[model samples]
Structures are given as C-alpha cells and as structure tokens.
Target chain A: MSGFSATLGHRSYEFADLRVLLAKATPLRSGDVLAGIAAGSAEERVAAQLCLADVPLERFLTDMVVPWEDDAVTRLILERHDPVAFASVRALTVGELRDWLLDYDTDAAALSAVAAGLTPEMVAAVSKLMGNQDLILVASKCAVVTAFRSTIGLPGRMAVRLQPNHPTDDLRGVAASIVDGLLYGCGDAVIGVNPVSDSPARCRELLDLLDGLIHEYAIPTQGCVLAHLTTTLRCMDRGAPVDLVFQSIAGTEATNRSFGITLELLAEAHAAARELGRGTVGEQAMYFETGQGSSLSAGAHHGVDQQTLEARAYGVARAFDPLLVNSVVGFIGPEYLATGKQVIRAGLEDHFCGKVLGLPMGCDVCYTNHMDVDQDDMDSLLTLLAVAGCNFVIAVPGADDVMLGYQSLSFHDAQYARQVLGLRPAPEFEDWLTGQGLLGTDGRLVMPPARHALLADPSGRPSSALPPG
Target chain B: MIPDEWSALRAMTPARIALGRAGSSTPTRARLAFALDHARARGAVNEPFAVADIARELARRSGPAVLSVRSAVRDRDEYLLNPALGGRLDDASRAEVDAAAGHPGTAPDLVVVLGDGLSAGAVNDQGVAVALAVGDAMGERGWAVGPFVIVRNGRVAVGDEIGARLGARFVVVLIGERPGLGATRSLGAYVTLDPRPGRTDAERNCISNIRPGGTSVADGATRIVELLTRARAAGTTGVALNP
Candidate 1:
C-alpha cells in the first residue's frame, strides 16, 4: 500500500497507513488523543482530511482497519458486501461519496438501495468529512425501520425507551416511574429496565413485572430487562417472558471478550429470542447498545480511532436483525469525550453511521455528572438527533437515573421532541393511547384523570386513590 | 402546585419521578433540584479525601497499625483522565509497603485497603467505620489482620498490589463508587483471593452502594467479612463463587 500525503503552501502532511489516515482525519475527540493516534496539529488534521478525501472508496474494501483474521466484525462487513448494490457508487472517491450523499437527488430510495453495499469504514470515512448538518441531512434522508410490538423508524414517527431504574430494583419504585412515563406518552420503543443486580432471579422478576403490565394493559409495546446475555439466556431457559435480548457490543473481539460475550454467544441468544416468537408486528428481537469509547475502555481498540470502532459495532448489530440499537453517547466520562462539543459530535456521527449501515439507530443522550456537560448540552444533542430522525432515545423519569448514576432525556423531553417536530409515537401505540383517552386530537397527551386505567393495580383496582384532576 | 397524586408516587422510591410538567418540560423546582444534586455529586468527585483524619480514626478503633499511601496519579484531574495510573502504587508507596511487610513475622490472613476512588467524600465519610468493623470481625475469628493501608486517588485494583506485597491470603478493598444523582457518598467493597497485579474485575466480587440511605456501613462490613470467608472456603471470588 502507498502512503497517504497532502500539502499546503508552507507544510505537507503524511500518514503511514489507512488506519493512520483514518484516525488523523477524524474530528478532534479526546479518545483519539488518549489512544495516541490523533493528529498533533490542527493544520495536520485538515491536511489528513484532504488526503483522505481523495482516496478511492474501493480502498476500504481492499484494506481493513482491523485485520479480517483478528476481528470478526471486519469479516462480517466484508463477507456480507452486496456487489450488485455497490455497482451504483463503487467508482466514487470518499469525497465524492460525501457529495453524493448530500446531493438533493440522492433521495431515501437511492440511499436505501445502496445501503447494503456501503461498509462501516466507508460510512465512517465520509462522516468525518461532513459537518453536523450534513450528517443530519444525509441521515434524515435514509430510513431503517424495525418492528416488534411497536413499529419504529417510520417517517414522521419517534419512540422512547422508558427506563425506570431504582437503587434496589424495587418493583413499586419502578412501577411509579412507569406510570409517569405512560402519562407523558413515552415507552413506545420498549419499557426497558437496567436491573441493579445481574442475577438471573432478579432479571426474571423484572421481566415478569414488565410482561404482566404489558399483557394486562394491552399496551402496543415490548418489555425488556437489560441484563447480560448469559443471564438473559438463563432466564429464557427457565421460561421467562423474554422480549428483547440486550447486550453491549464493541468493534474488536477482545473488547467483546472483556464484556464476557462473543459473536457465537450473541448468535445463540439471537436464535433463542426468535425461537420464542413473541412479536405482534414484527420479529426483530435483539437490543444492542454501543458507544465510542467502550473498546478503548476495555483496552481493545487495536490502535483504531473510537469513531471507526463505533461504526464497526453497527456491523455487529446489523447481523442480529435487532429491533433497537443505540449508542449511550456520553455515559462514559470525560476521558474519551472530554467536553460537550465532543459528545454532541460523536452522537451525530454514530447515528449517521448506524442508519447508513441499515440499522434502526437510536441514542441515549446522556452525560455523567463528572463530565463538563449539563442538561442544556443534552437538550442541544437531543434536538439535533430528533432532526436527524433518530428512531428512539432513552427516557428516564426527570432525566435522572438514580441506579445508573447518569442524566438522560426525561419523559417531558421526549414529548417536546415529538410535539415540536410533528412526529408521533408508533402507530399502534398512538392508537392505543387514543383508545385510552390519553391522547388529545392534536396528538399531545391529554392527562387522563388520576384514576386512569394505567394506574390500576394488577388485581384490577386503583393502586392509589387520589383527588380527581 | 405539585399534584397530590404525583407526590404520592414519590414515596415509592428515591428516584426523581412524578414531577408535574411545566409547558411540556420539567418544572423549575424539579430542574433546580436536579441541578443541585448534580452539583453535589460533581463536588464529591473532586473533593479531597482527609487521609490523615481517616487514618487517625482507624488507628483509634482498630488494633492494627494504620498507614497512608498514594497512587501514581498526582491530582484529581489526572486521576479521572488516566485510570491506568491509579491502579498501581507510586515508587515511594511501594517501598513503604515492602518495608512494612519485612517487619511482619508471619503473613496475615487478610489485608484491608481503603481507597479514595471517584468519590473521595464516600471514603472520608465511611472508610474508618467499615474498616474497624471488618477488623473486629476477623479478629473474633482468630485470623491475623494486617495493617490498614489508606490509598489516595487509588482504583480498586490497587489493593491487589498492596496485599501481594504484604503476603496476605486475601485482600479486600473498600473504595468510593462514582457518585450518582441520588447517592454522592456511596462506597463499594471489592474482595479478591490470592491477590496479584493482573487480576480483572471478573475475578473479584463487589458489594456496592454502601451509604447511609443505601447499605449501612455496619452491614457492608459484615457482608465483606462473610464474602471473604466464603472466598477462602471456595478458593475463589467473582463469578466462580456464587453470592
């Protein structure tokens, strides 16, 4: 392979390999700096971008960032390439691909037709060259929808994952938050809970709780207990009502090892969830969460940049035919992202890459307290992602997750996004809300009386009697 | 006014829920409450641990000698940025541990390390109380307990090196967990058997959320002692020994 080089009037820049060029061209983020692969100077970074823009898109297919022999993700991307779809844009350079994506002539059908041919490396490379608006506009044109109990990623639609976590995994505590979210018209994506304990018994209990609520209320949504794959598998074997098998995956095999998972293990879990056949609208039954810094956090980045590694994770998600995939963007602290600007940029980039790779991508727009971020930054990212047509986002009560120790979007925030953008929840969920008198004519929540059926106890009585509204 | 039904739901959990909306957003009171909690948790992350005061308290309550040590990280900023640096002792602290181990006639059965992890306030609030309780429990069992080593800006793995240097059969690290919006001063205890430098989190057992509103300090200490005893009997910790 030939070295990549670019020049200005006074100075010239050179990168030794494709990996080096890709890392140097990436937008400035703390993860690259921590990995010692980021460009040292601003001018050097621009020059690398210039050099990368001229590289042929075909070069990505020929040269892998992580070797195919060492990483299963690389093999998955290469082996699954669709030559017929690639014939449309196979001749374009990386810069040309960016222009092609942003062109008004490139409609949703055009992008969708070529989605199977575009590799993660090709998508991540083009994303590095585009601005945030370009990322949004391109992603907004592409549509990747999945369905289970609720349909997600449909045009003019959005969804929320109601996360009602408690310090001790208390049932009533979780139920209270669920009521709050339901009142605000959230939880269409999935009513998922991150259990404090990963024990199979606790997971089974949470799963049963969510299953009982969904069945009793006849809500048009799925229930998920966000536990380890092994733990979820154990619960499945014991006859638990498993809706979606959740796991955190990474780009490299070693990072997946650090998470105590492998491709084969994920495949097994995916097959088991499908075997249960629990979907009403569709059968996509896996939920995957990925982020930029997880590979580096596990000491398994293989000298690759975080953004590319994040894109590689989408390759893993696409293989499972997952119902939902999201990047918990700012949950990892400032060591990798460092600032709000970095977090916002990473959120856009991850969304664009995942959508282009033919996956129903969402985002957990969150930040740890220790990061230099606040709710305002979260608000900015949330609105941008909404405009970018994110399928769903996590909605915790008041945006404060007491058990996970992070701040995410609140139920009100999800409502605000839907109302402002003229988007509605999944059609089935919206119809159910209308039937329950919880949605007004304008598609806004109607605030049913204090004795709403959603608040009824499992025994068909009001759980708490309160004054009428 | 906050609705009666919303307020009724707040009693179920410490989680911030049922805050009535203000124009499709969180009400001002709920927003400010969240900000205040976040500020407190962030403050706890940067707050300096009172090592000398904690050491003094441990010495007064426990029979074993108390020693203070520092990790390779020089400040809170570096501690947050470079986590690998916080997992090992500095040169001076390594030498101190070696010298302290030389005077010991026989290897102690267990060593307790108190570390100021992400939340220094957590260790400052409950480190000594838990240490003294664990020491008393081990003493009653007639096991030799080594000196309590208080580590500054240390991670959970730091105890492995300290225990290996002292030639203990087991090591228990009582460290501060990352502060959350609900609990800022929460501590966690990690137990490892046959301590060494290359141990992973999968090879250790953890008991978390040790605070006033969460797990009480006394209960945390008792659980630690029981877990360590189980680890000794099974000759393992982490996933190998069922909780």
Candidate 2:
C-alpha cells in the first residue's frame, strides 16, 4: 500500500485484500493471558510424576477418623506404569479411574511422584491447608465438636459461600446457585450448595418455602441452606450485618481466591469474640458461616489493578469476624507478596493465633521444578508463612503441592483446616477429600486433635521444640 | 492534494521495510507476515524489530522532496499496556519524532497513520469513525485534508516515520484502540506539530477520532487551522505553549 499528496506531500497506506487478514487471524482477547497461570504447562509435567506413596496432604486430613479410600488414581497409575500389571488392568477399570482423576486431581502427575518431589517445608504446609471441607458428614461432625467445646475454644468455623445471582457459568454464580438457590448446577462440582439467600428480596421467597417446614424450627430456614458470602466492611449492614457475596470487591482478581475462604472463618470468629466479650455466649452461633467465605475467582493475574488493591486493603482494614474465617488460607508458594507476609508476620509476632492460618497449597515444585512462579527462593519462604500464624499444612499423601503448581492444590487448604482444626479422623476426612464415593473408603488418615491432659498431657502443649535427648 | 504540479509522483519501496506477499484481498496477512519475518530473521540478533516500513504505492501523486515523519511515544510503558493513552504520542514520543526529522522547520499539511498496536481487529473496529471525526475537526479553517494511512501492527513510530517522509506541515494519526475482554477493538488518534516525527505531542494539535469522544477529524479542521495559526505565532510546541 502506498500514496503521496502533492500539495501536502503526505503518504497514504493501502491494503491488498481482506481474506489474507482473516487467514492470519485467530480470535484473540485478554483472558488468554491467564491460560497458563490458572492451570496448564505445569499440570502436564507435575501429573506425570505423581504417585500415591507421596500424597502427604491426603494422609493428615483423615487420619483414622471415618475411614480412607484406596488411591484409585494411584492404583490405576500403578497398573499402567507398572509393566507387570498393565495387562491385568481392564479397560473399564482404567476409564473409571481416569474419570475419577479428572474430577479430583489438581494436576496430571501420579500420586507417589507428587510425594517424592516435596521438600520438608512443603510437607508442613500441605499438612496445614487440609481442612475447609464441604462434605455434609465432616461439617456436621466439626459443628458438633465446636458446639461441645464452645465454652473453652473456638472450634472451627463451618463457613459457606454463594453468589446472589445465579449465572449459569463462572465460579461465583455456580457456588451461589447451589447455596442460595438450592438448584443443582456446575457449582456442585466445585463447591457445595446452600439454599439460603442473603438478599432481603430473595430471602422473602425462601421464608415462604419455610412456611410448611416451620413445624419444628425457630427463625424460618426451610429453603435457606447455609452458604458463604463475603462483603466489604462497608457493605456489612450494621443493623442486620449481612451482604451478598459478589458485590464485595474482595479477591476480584484471580490471585486472591484465598481471601474468600479466610474471610469465611474470620467473619464467624470475630462476631463471636465481640458477643462473647459482651457476655452474649448463647446467641445461637450468630449466623456465622451462613454468610461467609467469599473466595475470589483466582482466575486472572492482572497483577493487582487500582480497584483490586482498594478492595483488598478495605477487607484487611476491617477486622475479620471469627465465625467464617476462624482460619485463613495462607500462601507458602510464589504468589505470596512481601506485603502479605509482613501483615501475617505481624499478626503472629503479636500472637494472634486463632485469626489466620497458612497451608502451602503450592509447594516449590509447583513453582519452579513445575515452572509456576519461577521463584528459586521459595523453600525458605515456606518457613516464613508458617511463622506467620499458619498452623495446619497441606502436603499430598507423600507429595507436596509445590509453588510452580500455583493454586493447583489450593482446594487442599479447606481439607487440612477441617481435618486438623476440627480434629476429625480418617473416614470423615477421607469422605470430604475424595467425596462420598466407593474409593473414599481407603487410604485415609484422620489424626485427631491431640488434647492435652490438665495434669501431664503431651496433647495439651505444643510438642517440645526443645529436641529429644 | 498533491501540489497541483507534483502530480506525476511515482511509487518507491523504502530501504528499511520489506514488502511481503500482498497477493490477497487485505494487506493484514502481508503485514503480519512482515512482522513475523522481521522478528524471526532478527532472531537472537534481536528480540523485537522495533521498526517497520511500508510506503503507499499511489500510482501517481506528488513530487519527491524527501521528508521523514515519526512520533516519539513518551511513557512507553503506559502506551504499550494501557488502552487509555492511545490518543496522543506521549512527550518522549515527541522527542523521538523530532530526532527523526532531518529537517523540522519545513512542516507538512497532514500526517496520517495508524497506531496503538492493540490489534488490527481493534483498529478496524474503532479507526474508521475516529478518522471521520478527525476529518471534520480539520474542516473549520477550510484546511484541506489529503489522504489517510492505516498500518497494521503499528505503534507511534510509524506515524513519526511517515510524517517525516511526507513533508506535511500538520499530521494526525488515527490509531487502533487496545482490546479488552469485551471490547477488543477500539480507535485512537495522534497528532504531530510541524508534521515532523521528533516534535512532541505538545507541538502537535489533535482532536482524536473522526467520531465523538474525540475532536472528530471533521471537527478537527477548524482546530487544526487554529493550532497551525498558534504555532506560527509561538514558534514552538512543548508543555509551555502548544495550541
């Protein structure tokens, strides 16, 4: 293309045709930028090497509670990778196991390979982020434990979250559909469902549904399935103290999904601490987890825009309620910012334990060996997150979710929180980890919260960091 | 509007740019090929081509007085990633444009070019309206507009390069807008003073977009005359005194 204006002496550009342009085009947009950050490149590499023996996280969550399930993924992997058993494994069996892997697996590697790659630091982290399960069984058990120990401890917050508007797609809408709408959708695959609506308008509809079921309960809750919803501090109505989840700008970007889960626990505990401080001990759990745990999409990494930062700072300024985020999901991987680390460390040095916790969802391998964050200095960082008030860790059975994995193992955070904090054992932990399925019965470990004896108890006090003779 | 006399203008291929296969309906494929080839050929030799060249093969037009046009896009970081700054070549852009101008005193009448390397699709979506707006903006003073140029994979420099070459006293680049998720294609504008590449955004006068939200080129006509009149008076273009 060429041209020139005699008087103006200006040149003009031309195009030979349009079809050539179409040939060179392949629909492009900004979302594609997150293709790898969410779950890609790293998945393939990590999946190939995982083995059941290394699933460190799987072990701690259900240590002897209900029961454990056999490692279906591992068994299938073994049957294939193992030349001796390859032929013995039937096509139908492999297909079923493959389907299971698709449902539960956060990566592509075998379970044992996942374990072998872990460093000691990662093991501690995965072990911690193992709670926050949605299994009806675990939630009921934990609620009972928390209820019994109400006078002495703040058991664990049984938080739930849901979006108000039920969009057929995306994480927020899906979670909300199940929780508030009570309608089953894609959300059942990711988070649990609750029929409770926080919006006054929608709640009225729920109240109507409860008209017939009220034959036995007090505050109409027939259709109100307990769900988690997070709102900005400003959004909270001082009078009613409730807000829808999506409206709150917390974790708006993809990197801050943990904020939602942590908020869930904080909401519950903070409200209780205030009431208990005021001698209102029997206020019926103060609608804690019913409207907590609003997690961000954790889908994009636009690096904190102005809006995103404002939202985060706002959430932080407002102290967390102890009910939903009674526990936090801290970062032990590459995404951990110095800013976040400083805040968490201050909380720890100041000795605020019940407020937040860390579970190294993404271990070193997930970061570098796996290529997620590329942070060579991650091993030492894990120690810092732990020091910052992180109690439970979430490593795989024998493996650790490395940094390069990003949030590939983030789901494990809730697992460790529920398993370790609530003190439930194998079967219960197993049930939630793998869901209530046939395989949910094997290889579970639900180590109960070791209680301390008033007299000479090893359980009551933290183990002597003083070293054995 | 080749001067009523230099109408016998013949086409010439630029020394720096390579003409790819223009064997199709749209030149975009050829543009993309050029970019990819430049990148690949320059391989470890370099990472980014940083420069591209394409001349309008107008069958017949103006005389050959050898002119250079280019824009020094200041706040490079902001422009590369930001969709908002697409309207004008930043301060640094002016400096670069000035430097590229072998002769800055001889200003050209019109500087036309495409910009905001967002995407060709974005340009197609937003550029046309912006062009019309610029045209209307230039109409008030009865300042006659010449021809328009749209470059693919274009950044601010392409404007500077052509403006410098065309020898126009005034030049404006209607560029492509950055593509977001829902709004992938949009348009922008860039104007240059003295129609030279090295001059800064301050030296130039611009009413972006041939459409609203910008000084539509149609509306820009009167404004362009006013700017030229002011430049003729102030003898400069910068933060201090630009029309």
Best-matching candidate per TM-score: 1
lDDT of each: 0.89, 0.29
RMSD of each: 2.8, 25.9
lDDT of 2 by residue, A1-469 (tens): 2211111125222212111111111112111221212112232212211221133322322231111142221222122233332222123221232232234442323322322222211222222212122111111211111111112122232211211222112222222122211110011111212332344444333323232222221111112223334322222333222211211223222223433444334454445334433222222222222100122123232332211122222223123322122212223211221123322322222112122111111111122111122122232233332322222222211111211112111222223333333432222222332332212233322211223111123532222110111
Looking at model 2, residue A389 earns an lDDT score of 23
TM-score, cand. 2:
0.28
Instruction: Give the poorly placed runs of model 1, Cα more than 4 Å off.
Output: A456-469, B1-6, B59-63, B103-105
TM-score of chain A of each: 0.97, 0.24
Superposed by TM-score, candidate 2 places the C-alpha of residue A380 at a distance from the truth, in angstroms, of 29
B53-159 per-residue lDDT for model 1 (tens digits): 99888888878888899999998877877787889999999999988884557988889999999888999999988888998899899889999999999999999
Distance from true location, Cα of B170 in model 1, Å: 2.4
Question: How many angstroms is residue B7 displaced in model 2 relative to the true structure, after the best TM-score fit?
Answer: 63
